[model samples]
Target chain A: MESWEILLQQVINGVSLGAMYALLALGFTMVYGIIELINFAHFNIFMVGSFIAMWVMQLMGFTGQSHVLYGLPLTAMLVFVLCVTMVATGVLGALIERFGLRALRGVSGTAPMITTIGLSYILFNVILLGAGADTKNYSNPMPNIRWEFGDAVLHLRELILWGVSLVLMLALHYFVRRTKMGKAMQATAQDQEAARMVGVDVDRVVIITFFIGSALAGAAGVIFGLYYNYTNFGIGYTAGLRAFTAAVLGGIGNIPGAMLGGVLIGLIESLGGQYLAVRWTDVIIFSILVLVLVFRPTGLLGRASPTKS
Target chain B: MPISDAPQTQSQRRPPLLEFNDVNTYYGELHVLKGVNYRVGDGEIVCLLGGNASGKSTTMKTILGIVRPKSGVVTYAGKPIDRLPTAERVRRGIAPVPEARRLFPRMTVLENLEMGAFTRTDTDEIEADKERVFGLFPRVKERLTQLAGTLSGGEQQMVAMGRALMARPKLLCMDEPSMGLSPAFVEQVFDIIQAINKQGTSIFMVEQNANMALSIADYGYVLQTGEVVLQGSAQSLRDNEMVQQAYLGEMKAQ
Candidate 1:
């Protein structure tokens, strides 16, 4: 492969990886945006989402061959799995907010942060006990067809992953911009008291924020499992750290910032791994984070003031 | 006697649009509103006057259900609204221009207006109300796409008032509309307050600027240390010797 082709390949790989991170980063940014809580459990939600998808796939007897179920083909079944995973994860996210975080309302900021960390631990343990400690293989049913531009090969799976992430991002943008409920979400994020005074049901807004943010994370989890071909109870820790880094890199409270930051981090990880040793990829990512904190503390797109809504 | 049970004075016979009957509110152990009684009639502007820490804003919050009264009935249009949620009270046509014109700092003026009409489902009416708000504050129309925080103080106040009007509220509650404004802007704000009142929107305002508040209010209540010290027609409060010395900044021979 030519040097340019290698660069292009790395770019493609980075974007695909970034798309996964973007999914998780959005959850972090959104939860932080609404309530200023760094919800550690969000990462666990993503891990659980992937596990749920794997279990569903196994129970349904889905394999590499396209099989029809309920007049739906293999692709449709995948969509079904996606929907189920998203809803389950969304509900889990909402329940965590209701029982864990909401109960800590009006308490010191440290309380909710610590509670989420505890929730993450509980979720990790629950999955560990239920699924066992071994890493479960997540089979990719999609045909492994690759399109080549010169020496840079693009897999069909990468295209689907990128396409879905883009579509979800666009849908989220439309929801936040055009929909009434979305506006209410933004308003509630801006000022809960003012939002209430203006007739916004702030409690409902917080619940919906968790639902959407977690659903996105769930989608990411399913995609991560399908791409990486494995699921484990402990994936949430490393994955959540990277996504949280992306959120901070892009400016924690800003939506577009999180998206951009995730993609950038993905590109850096891929290219850094290609150029340097694969083991040094995390060191490289954290180095970039330290640089950002020291130089431009608000991240690339975040404003100095915490007013993104 | 329960203030709600007291018969309306003969001169003002219409049932009160909003009646705060002997409200007592506390923030933990700190008593904030003590035996407060006042009423705002339909299409009337009732201004609550006090210095800082006099529980004027707390009284506004009590009516909107943010600060629940320990005892007393807060009745809106003869129906008790003390138990209603803050959003529920706002949905029932009570809107507030809160202190410092708390516009969503990051949102565009247009989006802020959208938030004001959050409780309403009638799309056509909401659109019409937006137009009415624009008419009331043309500066807001010009700054529709501008982020609210970037606006000048006077312009922000316009957006805040425009946001409140977008609700098409029956009774508009304002907390210190004249706070942190130039003298000229204060005058302009007061003028707009009267103009809004003329359009059949009753106003319940809390302010320290007794001179401007009393000028536009139909009735007035003087609060001191969480208790109603005096209440009467706006004209009477403006001329009262005690009110003149304390609030109106007017002094006669000591």
Candidate 2:
């Protein structure tokens, strides 16, 4: 158990890393599905979510990176903060949709897209001005506990991250496929005019898409913070790009594709960072993105199967 | 030319379910519907006939509130819906079988039908409506689990109609229900449209197949370049030289 099973270790690391990217990628695919906007601000929503979780911990007098609440208390605190952060980020996403993109709905071309980039800057600058340029330590509520298995080790934290991700993703899948509102989202994505003909409030659908997509990003934010132990205004730049690549790698507008793409990219980053020169991680990730786009623009699962959105 | 008793030619035989009064709809600078005024009477199958770019589709869009009238009022069930959004119009007992049968291709036929009743909350009644749709188009029942996109063109049309029926609409607005069907399916579709109209829902259909449309329509309107050039009872229009020449393809061959 003392030996490092490089491959096994890399796979473990990749899954956890991929989990964060998966959550973030969900937001991109959904927003793109419904309104055809990239919502560049979504990356910052994850960053802001991390900061908000940090602040929530701080408000509870748990301010340091060493802030640890174990057993039952830890569970309660994590759940509380996760719920709060998801809501805050969901509302933030909805607000951006309402004021920022609603007016430019039918303006044609990249105006809405450019607005998203502008919105991204606003979110980034707000964090920069409100906090600081320096990387702020995120309070880790869970201790770095490990379980040994043969030559490899499993972190309880990674398992928890993966568990939470799997649940949220399943819930989202059920909602989209089974629930009325979720189907409305899918209907809007396929054909907005047809959706409207059936009496779906397309504008309202747009807002909901932002809410759900951004809320997932918020969860990723908390996970990202817990994994990396710190966050900065610039985290969105690197993390966001990776997640976007993941979304595009899967079908851009596909739900499950984003999740698959996220995990795949996360694994790619981890193994590439370890095996290749650590510096070439970004190049490898983007290279895959370029290859996927060039060869299969629809992503891995973007094939003509059902459940496209 | 046809059965004079197909439907009462009179506009007020029953109360008008939908009315467009001097409504002018614009797509930016292009005025699509020019001061259009029309009505769909309760329980009658009314068809709007026109060629391409003649504002037939825009007329359908205007009634559904997809495109708002720049001026004038659109009334449904005695309420003005000119300013209402498409959702509100649908809520007020209107539904559409849009052109090309725009089904959510990735969804199951059952799911597509469920979506037709998106605005309804009556669980028991929705079930009842589903049964009713299945009864009307029995093939839909067999393909409930199949993805809508996998169905044939004719089957898709059936699902589209079945989906519209799921809403329990008082007024069913259909655009080009016979556009791309084989002659046999076209006949079947017209027969189904009549059957639906007979079941107490009003029909407001826009079609380029004037010959088939006139056969089922109670009343008809002809639009040429965004203006109502001619309108009359189906029998009268079928007998008119202008209608025969322009729409019914009754012109003499060279």
lDDT of 2 by residue, A201-226 (tens): 99999999999999999999999988
lDDT tens readout by residue for model 1, A1-309: 999999999999999999999989999999888888998999899999999998888788864335324323656877888899999999999999998889887788598899999999999999999989998888677777799988999998898889889988999989987898999888877888889889988888898999999999999999899789888999998888999989989998788999999999999999999999799999988888888889987889976343522
* Overall lDDT per candidate, in order of appearance: 0.87, 0.89
> How well does candidate 2 score on lDDT at residue B209?
86
- Steric collisions counted per model: 0, 0
Q: Give candidate 1's iRMS in Å, 1 decimal.
A: 3.3
Kindly list the per-residue Cα lDDT of model 1 for residues B137-215, writing each as its tens digit: 8888999988988888899888889889888899999999988889899999999999999999999999878888898
Question: Each prediction's DockQ?
Answer: 0.55, 0.58
Q: After superposition, how far is residue B217 of candidate 2 from its true place, in Å?
A: 1.4
Taking the tens digit of each residue's C-alpha lDDT, what string does model 2 give over B56-140? 9999888888888899898999989888888888888899999999998888899999999999999999999999998889999
